[model samples]
Target: MMRVGIDIGGTKTQAVALADSGEIAASVTLPTMRGEDAVLATTTSSVVALAATAGRELGEFSSIGIGIPGHVDRVGGRVRNAVNLGVRSLELGPALRERFGIPVEIDNDVTAAAAGAAHLMSLSGTVAFLNLGTGLAAGIVVDGVAWRGQAGAAGEIGHLPVDPHGLECPCGQRGCLETIASGAGLRRAWPAGGAHPGRGLVRAMESGDADARRAFEGLVSGAAGCVRILALSIDPQTIVIGGGLSRLGEPLRQALGATLREWSGTSPFIADLKLPERVQFLPENTPAAAVGAALVSRT
Candidate 1:
């Protein structure tokens, strides 16, 4: 039987059917609708589309797993505080299970991405996934299992206050890492870049836009801080950069590595950690969260 995995993002929803051999057999993407009802409907539609693409009935799927942004109650299969999706609270797992007559699992999107990255990259030991999307967050995996931590807030590094007088975060914190490294941060720093600031950042910088350069540098510096924090705290074997902003690709990787190397020049301990060599970027266009949700469902 195939396992179905869905990744519900702020802008899009993607679903995939994984064959028994663990390869994706079918996949579908749809625009995600906001609100509890609309989000649920979007998820259902994704599954339906995936089933049709796979040429199988829904019953043929053994289980369904979902990766969504929010405060997920993994045990209870509930989600709340998903501001991007406009979901104040939702009983997503129960609703989906009832509709499909199968087991459903819910997890944080970043966590699912970590799992998917680990699986897809064939990584072992400790792996950390740093998500640089609209927001900054991280997820850790040891061996094949994810470490969600107590209260499921383990990798919420975005809220960690870094500057006492920096811009205020929606989380009510000043100078949060998210305020420096995330897409939201970029928008604030380069308001002229419009809603999706990261998209045109390189072009703007190449055209000698000082504001864009400053914003991009800030993102790199903030991201380097996150890597330092991860290295000091979890000391993971590999730190994988994933998320929308990761599409910045080689330039992002080179900038991050250079920053880490510069920091290493200041401290022997950091130099010994080989932080620059440990960094990696997720392959573009990989549906890591969806694949990860399917992998998580198996557990």
Candidate 2:
């Protein structure tokens, strides 16, 4: 059976029809509109258009899944307090399931991405998937299933209290890791503050830009802290990086690896073992969260 997956982001929404073995039969993209109704309408229109393009009908799809932008109550099928979508406590699964006449799922986008990463790296006993974009988050997979923790707040490393007295985060915390390492954080780190790739600032560091280098150094410091913490706790066999910054290729990997090397020293938690050689580089990366949303049925 075909599955329709939709991913709603801050600037765009994407939907894909997935068949066996990850073949994409149909796909759609729509500019994210300003309101909830507009977002749904735009998505439906795109689905219809894609159906026409494929010479089929949307009714052929067996299930629909939506990867939403906030903490998701997966069991309740609700999107809880999405700041980007201007939505709070929206019952996306019920609404869409009722409308589409099929099972519908609403899950956090990062969770979806993590699932995709896990499937892509099938050798995993345990795995970590990290997305560094406009925001930062991660997903954990163990024995091929996501571990979402009791509060459905797993992989929320951003709010993990990296600095007790550093800076106040919009998430109402002092010096959360996201406040120091995300795209917004990198942008804020710039003194000139003109326009730069918030995600690519690490590469900008290599270019010998003094301010950019300093900013990225700070990012490495925070990132090292994150890696160390996760390494001690999760002990993942593979760690995959997705999102805007992962496109930097080897430079980003090497720099981050260097930091990891430093952080690994003299720590009984790490014990001089090398990090797994499982960092994947998907050249033409999919918006995995969108594709993973589509894969909910398979999961």
Best by lDDT: 1
What lDDT score goes with residue 224 in model 2? Answer: 59
* Top candidate (TM-score): 1
Q: How accurate is candidate 1 locally (lDDT)?
A: 0.92
Q: Pick out the ten consecutive residues of candidate 1 with the lowest summed lDDT.
A: 144-153
lDDT of 1 by residue, 1-299 (tens): 99999999999999999998889999999999999999999998999899999999988999999999988988788999999999999999999999999999999999999998998899999999999999999998899688999878888898999889889999887999999899999999999899888789999998999999999999999999999999999999999999988888778888998999998999999999999878889999999999999889878
Against the unseen true structure, what C-alpha lDDT does each candidate score?
A: 0.92, 0.71
Off by over 4 Å in 2: 191-196, 199-208, 265-273, 276-278, 281-284, 297-299
lDDT of 2 at 180: 68
Q: Which ten residues in a row have the lowest lDDT in candidate 2?
A: 276-285
Error of 2 at 98 (Å): 2.8
Residue pairs in steric clash, candidate 2?
Answer: none
